[model samples]
Target: MNHSSDLISGAATAATGTQTTSPEPPPRRRLSRPERERSIVEGAVKFFAEVGFDGDTRELTRRLNVTQSLLFKYFPNKASLVERVYQEVYVGRWNSYWEEIVADRRTSLQERLVRLYTDYAKTALTWDWVRLFMFSGLRGEAINQRYLGFLRSRILEPVAIELRAELGLPGPDRVPLNIQEIELVWGINARIFYFGQRRWIFNVPLESSVEELVQLTIEHFIAGANVLVPRIVQAQIDAAPAHAD
Candidate 1:
């Protein structure tokens, strides 16, 4: 069995390409899944981490010391493996975290967002394949749509409704935000995802570490949301005077 060095190179190279120094994933926890599935994803993550999303399946099998059929028995195809690995690496823990945060209202919405950023930051530092899919995710429409829902239901929806009631504001009215507000929050999230994940993918400047990015995002959102809410309420009140009978 022989795997090309480019096995983890293709998609990464396709994105920004050609780096001399590369890092490897730390020993992944065995808690990943059943042995067969865990082995498949861990290998897949290594390939994506080393080569990138476009890494060749043929090389993957060679590295796995398995036939294509054997590989497919677990993952089906390259894209399917990428999806499975993505879920195992990034999505699984995150969804579990979602369950915990969703039930807790004692924490502020901003706190929940920061917790998420911090979690991903830690994962990016230790998990190689996770960082790859994060970068690659920006390109997939289906992933993007699902990602939006993940944000809306798990974080934004609960927070928005709570904030609206707390401030004595009409629910999602001109007082503060609408559906578009979720996209604004997504922009902040994109920054956290971009720089953290981009570090391994493009070897971009880590002018700041992962935790710093998460902290900065949390701080900025707190400061900005405060300012944004008032302006929205003012706009509504100013318009109210004209509408009065």
Candidate 2:
């Protein structure tokens, strides 16, 4: 009856009757570029969800019913495809929201950052590909670099700049943001959002529906950040993400 329960019901329905991976390929045979990409990406998510970033490409392609060479032509090599998948497929449509928020100027900085993270949490629960993104973050450097790009550009820089102006942050907020702190906060909210998405089947408790959770989370951050004297009000910046604590 609650939002999480409703989301759980809807996701369960949407996940049914649809084959996640394409049919297997021919024995000892290669595949076309598009087919290889399709097979590898689709199968890769399964591997990512289970085995993570270092998941075997051989097994991945084979499951797609294609030869390794077929997969190679499309990806060139295994490591490279990991980068592509992280950026292109794993993040996918999520990046569009990224560009808009980072560039949009119609909302306050506080609104922008909260909107960004809340939207992120909501999408994580709903987007099937997010499983791959979440799992991949644990692998190592290749994934770490991808993570860094996201933090620096999408998360940190925007927050650093906007927080400075919005809160008139006078201390460390002006200097370069700390990576460790950024990663910590990023992980915390990500964990919460992910739990909300899975809705207890994964064994994590959900406190609210995805939509309500996002709204409450946004408000919490705004209230916490507004403690700075005379919260700077900018009505032109697009709503997105941030935090120091």
Off by over 4 Å in 2: 1-32, 102-105, 126-130, 168-201, 228-245
Best by lDDT: 1
Instruction: Name the weakest run of 10 consecutive residues (lDDT summed) in model 2.
Output: 229-238
Task: Assess every candidate by TM-score.
Answer: 0.66, 0.60
Local accuracy of candidate 2 as per-residue lDDT tens digits, 17-128: 5546888876875656676576677676566656667678887876777788867877898777776766655456455665478456588865675667666665555444
- RMSD values for the candidates in order, in angstroms, are 15.5, 16.4
Clashes of 1: 6
lDDT of 1 by residue, 125-238 (tens): 554734565546655625445656776777666665655554566765544456545555666656766775556667766787677778888788767766676566557667
Identify the candidate with maximal TM-score.
Answer: 1
Model 1: lDDT of residue 120 = 55
User: Model 2's lDDT to the true fold?
Assistant: 0.59
Q: Which regions of candidate 1 are displaced past 4 Å?
A: 1-34, 107-113, 124-130, 134-141, 172-177, 205-209, 233-245
